[model samples]
Target chain A: MLVSLAWRNIWRQPVRSVLSLIGLAFSSLLLVFMLSFQFGVYDTIKIGALGLFDGFGQFQPEGYDDDPDISKQLPGSQALLAADQIKGVSATAPRASSFAILANGDTSFGAAVIGVDPAREPAVSTLYSTISEGRYLEPEDSAAIVMGAGLVRNLGLALGDNVTMLGTGNDGAVAADVLELVGIFSTGVNAVDRQITQMPLARFQETYNMGENVNVIALRGPDFNGVIRAAPDLQGLAEAEGAVYLRWDDLQPEVRQMITLDLSTAMLMYGIMIVVVVFILLNTLYMSVLERTREFGGLMAIGMRPAQIGAMVWLELVFLSLLGAGIGIALGAGITIWVENVGISFPGMEDVLGQWGISGRVYPDLSFFSASIGPGIIVGSIIILGLIPYRRILGLEPVSAMGAA
Target chain B: MKPIVSCRGITKVFGKGELAVHALRGIDLDIMEGDFATLAGPSGSGKTTLLNMVGALDHPTAGEVAIDGQPLSGMSKSALSDLRLNKIGFIFQAYNLVPVLSARENVEFVLRLLRVEPAERRRRADEALAEVGLQGMEGRRPSALSGGQQQRVAIARALVARPRIVLADEPTANLDSTTTKELVDLMYRLNQESGITFLIGTHDPRVMEHSKRHIEMNDGQIESDTRG
Candidate 1:
């Protein structure tokens, strides 16, 4: 009977009830989209940073990350074979890098010269696909280098131009080579474009006097998120070889920090939005209670306990909030699924995204958590804010409330 | 027989200091079991205030009120509510039927408060509504019923629990003369048939004419008391 009464009472002011429902639904929709967008941007950042050259993560010689000397190389063939055997690892590429100087005629600049297997490197790094000019290195291309666009400009060199490279070799001798520029790649990172170069692995090994050895073994999988979940397995593989495994967080701490900060800010904003929704609900319930003061008083006069009256009011709020939240969840899930399938792109924000290594197109994440979080908060807020009216009902004196005009 | 409702020197002050309005001043009243009494007074004459005191709906400032020998002065709020629910029923001047409920639902409300079994509550609500001449209109909401029908529903609600006493404050004020007479006649018949007591506050002469006893008030004090 109480439930029936409460349900009917809600429709007494149809316009007000509908408006309140719409407000709650709008809040739910906003919450769902905001959380989805935030997580989507985080995924984008992880892919952009980890996909450039390192794949999901990398396994390096214990001390090679701190000092990439020619002698500090791992057994490349053995590590690559072992990494390939690990489950969930889709691909692995071995690379040797050294800080060297490139010179072309009167122009010269310092560069991080990276040695990579031409055919296998493309399978692990997005750098292969981001080449702006010239073709990527082929398997048979010896003494050939792929320079960044900034590096090419700094050294005044063009594609197919011979450039002299000078660095220390594994034998403590001066390693010198004249390599033809086969590719000029631009990854949109100014530092990488201006100071990184890649060459065929055999030629690099011969020039650096490091035979069949490399500084790092990069691994790739279907997705970086799965790779993160497989971190324990990756770590075991690294430990078996006396190597150090570096995930994206370990490789790019700054980007991780930025994501954490951005997430915190987003949550704070969402929290405020939730608070606003709660206040709107409070106002709606307060008005409903006020409007029915005499009715409640009559109920009390007829021997309705304060707690029972409170329960009726609470039940009304639960019904209203859950109805709105349910509708919002359905609407939000539909929009998210559609947006996830087609993707969203910011045409005018490409430059801004590029600065952070992210692409222009973003795919919203459609996970269970994102789908439920918005409606969950609204329901929780309703349960909590329902207490306000319950307390008001408890404090109402039947005689005074009955006399209220 | 002992009086069912007893009030001694009941004084009710609404405000304080110079702003105080003495709504009831030194009122003494007694209502015996099975009595049909009317408290007659104009607005601000304290008839409703006295009725509220006897009904345990308000506290007297300087007096004692006892219903069925239980003094209301020190009783807890819940106890007073229980007393109202189980021993007394109230019918407001405005009819005060919960607008959201159907006629049957309104009649069954007090039974529900008393935690009566569902089947018994339905049976009692149906019987009470029939007694009030609202047969076959039990499912109609208050808005769907006429003023007289709504009042009948209110009467059914008040009588459904078979309370020892029913307190009514100008119950027929909104009804036409014909409906008012019918309502008064129904109350008189219920009093005679069921041996239930009634304390009504009204300025209407028709209500007074039907009552077995009439107590008139002026300026918060009883001015005349007459028995039929």
Candidate 2:
């Protein structure tokens, strides 16, 4: 009976009920949308970070952090063997790197040219699939090269266009060459895109005048843990070859940093969402209880106990919470589904995200738990705020409440 | 005869120190079961305070009150609420029916609080509304009824519990003279027929004339007690 009475009382002023519900819905919608966008960006970073550059993990020199020179290269043979021994290890590639000036026509720009065995490159890096034009590197072609999209643009070069490379060899001798652009690729990272290229390891060896000298070796496997687990064996191989072992974590600290920072930012935004939602719900429920003081007092005068009155007030708030939560979930899910399918592409925004090494079109990617948590938080906040006025109602002196304005 | 209500040197003070206001000072009263009694006084003459104390809605500051032989001073707030629910009924000057409830639901509210069976609650609510001359009007809300009709609904709510005492604090104050007379006649007949005790506080001469017995208060103290 009291439940019915409380339910009826809420509808007695339709405007108030609706306003409160709207307040809840709006807060919930904002939280859901924001979290979805954050998670979308997070997924982008993860894909870009782990895709072309660092596989899930890497093998590197033991003391590679202090001296990142040719002497710090992890021996390729044992790392490759260890990777093969792991059950789920999918693919591995070894790399050598050097800095040079890429010049085409009158344009010249500094670049870090990475050297790899073309046959093994595709097994480890998504670079094989990222080619926009021409073909990927081929092992027989020592002079062929894949230029970064931004680097190609900066040097004013096209596929099949010949560019001159000028740098010192590993033996401290001048090395120079004309290299043909085999393909143009984008890693999305501005630093990589503006100043990097991929070429055959033999070509790099020929240019550097070092018959077998490689500065670093990058490896890839199905599991990041598999790569990390092979580190000890990789170190022993490097010791045998008088080289040091290094891992991808040492090669790319930014990947680890980016993930950590993004998650922390998401947590900060979540806190802000909670506070904003609580205040809105508190204001709404406070006004509701205030407006109904007289009716509550009357209910008391008619022999309804204080506890019963409190229960009625609580039920009304729960009803409002359920209604708002239902609407928010439906709306949020609808928007997420639509955005995931159709996607939202802002003209210059793609470039902006690309500059941060993220994908162009923003797709709302979310797990069910991540998506549902937003609305659940909003509803939970409303219920908690609804209880704020309960103590006041229970403490209401019936005579004073009756006379209250 | 057993007294349905008894008060001994009851006092009620509001506020503290220099700001203090004593509403009821040393009030002593007792009325037997089945008495139709009215407390007559001017504004702020402590009639409402005395009535509230008897209703168990407010506690006396420095004395004791008993409702149907149960001591109110020693009871907890919840216990007092239960006592009011099972023994006492209240009627107000404003005809305080919850405006959202239909006349029938208003009467049913008290029975619901008493935990009466749903079927019996419905039947008793219907019977009480019919007795109040609102047989077909039970569906109407308080706003749809006249001031007199609203008061009758309040009366029905009070009687549906079959309580030992009905505390009516100026129930006819908001009605016209004709409505007041009609309501008084209705209540008097109910008192005579059912032998339900009533403790009404009012300054109206009509109510005093209509009541079988009257207690007059002056300056926070009872000045006279008379039987018609």
Candidate 3:
């Protein structure tokens, strides 16, 4: 009966009640949307970066990352042996990579030429599997180059087209070579697809006069657990050669740092929303307590304890908060799912995100854990705020309360 | 007869410092279990303050006030609330009904707080409302009822608990003369029929005339206590 009374009291001022509800809902929605956007961008970057690159962890030769010179290559034999010793290491590939300028007619662009053992490369990176149309490199196809789709277009080159590569070789002499385009790889990351060309290891060595050197050996691990398990020993080994063992995280510290900062920003923005919601609840409940002060006194006047009055008020708030939160959570989840599916595309901002190495379409990716936090915090805030008005029950002046106002 | 309420040298002060108001000064009184007494005084003459002290709603600044023979002065707040709840009922000038509750729920409000069984509470609430001549009006909210009807509901609420004493503070202030006469007569009938003690504080002459006893207050003190 008290619940019915309180529920009816809330509707006494229809406009105020609705305004409060809308304020809470709007606050909850904004918080959810911000969090989803941050989470979505994080996943998109992680997926895109790992697609072209190797695993969660990588093993490279001494000074290869800092200098990346072809002259710094570790012998393929030693790299293979070290790759085998890393626990949780799923697969590894030895690659000979170098910087060169490629030319076709009047169009010329700088490119990173990668020489991979094609069979093992697929195990370490998704580059071979992401090939949109043409076949990936094969062991017998040593002399051929596989270019990015966009790079192939910009150079006006295609399968069986000829391209020239020029570089200062490992011997400190100028060198040049011509190669046929055997295939194309599209990893959906524009930078890699537009500027990288893959060839077989022996052929790249022969053409670039690199002799028997391999620039870096990259590895793909099992999962998040595998990366953590293998990091310490791999770091130790890389340091022995004065090299840096970089995991996917180390490859882009700024990206990870930005994600951490963005998540905190998501929390701060959403925290402001939650606080607004708390105030709305407090206003509705306080107004309700004021309106019903006399009724509370009447109850106390006739054999009803003040504690009972306090309990009724608390119960009423719990019921209303549950109702509001139920509505808010359902609305938030509906919005989250809708946004996660079709994604929100910022027209002019796509290039901005692309420049930051983020995707153009913002897909809101909400974890089960992340989505659950919102309602928990909202309900908790309501309960904590509900205590303020209960002081009326303790100091309830029955005569004045029953008298008027 | 043993006194149902007793006040000895009870005084109540309001506000503080230079702006302080002394509403009641050294009131001493007692009423037997079956008395139908009215505290008659002009406005600000300390009648309401004495009544509040006797009803356990306000504490005296000094000295003692007791209800049902237990001292109310030094008892814990919860203890006083218990004394008020289990022993006393109150009716106010404005009828103080919860606007959102139906007449039945208003009465049930006390019964539920007292943890009365649902079926018993409904039956008692029905009987009380009927006794106040409000049969078949249990479902109406206070706003839907007339002034007289709402007051009757307040009486029913006070009486439904079957308290040993009922305190009325200007219970007929807003009622028309005819309605006031009817309400006083109903309360008198309840007193006669049920033997419940009644203590009414009012300035209305009609209320005093209808009462079986009257105590007149002057300034901060009672000047006369008369019994018919």
Interface RMS for model 2: 1.4
Write the residue-wise lDDT of candidate 3 on B132-224 in tens digits.
Answer: 999999999999999999999999989888898999999999999999999999999888889999999998888888788899998889899
| DockQ for every prediction shown | 0.62, 0.49, 0.53
Off by over 4 Å in 3: A1-5, A55-135, A148-179, A184-195, A201-248, A356-360, A374-378, A400-404, B16-18
Backbone clashes (count) for model 2 = 8
lDDT of 1 by residue, B1-228 (tens): 789998999999998999999998888888999899999877899988888788888899999999998899988778888999998889888888988888999999899888899999999999999999999999999999999999999889999998989999999999899999999999999999998899899878888888998898999999998989
Local error of candidate 3 at residue B133 (angstroms) = 2.0
Give the DockQ of candidate 2: 0.49
Relative to the real complex, the DockQ score for model 1 comes to 0.62
Q: What TM-score does chain B alone reach in each candidate, compared with the true chain B?
A: 0.98, 0.97, 0.97
Q: List the residue pairs that clash in candidate 3.
A: A303-B85
Q: Deviation in angstroms for B50 in model 3?
A: 1.3
Candidate 1 on A1-405: residue-level lDDT in tens? 678877887888899999988988888887787788778888888888778877788887777766766687664347554675666678888888888989998878998999998888887888988899899999999989998898899888888899999998878899899999989998888878998899998888899898878888888887777778878988887887778888888888888999999988888888888888889787977888888888888887888877788889988998899888888888887888888888889999987787667876888887789978878987898888899899888888888889877
- What TM-score would chain A of each candidate receive against the reference chain A? 0.90, 0.72, 0.71
Tens-place lDDT per residue, model 2, A133-163, is 8888987978989987889888888888999
| lDDT of every predicted structure (CA atoms) | 0.86, 0.78, 0.79
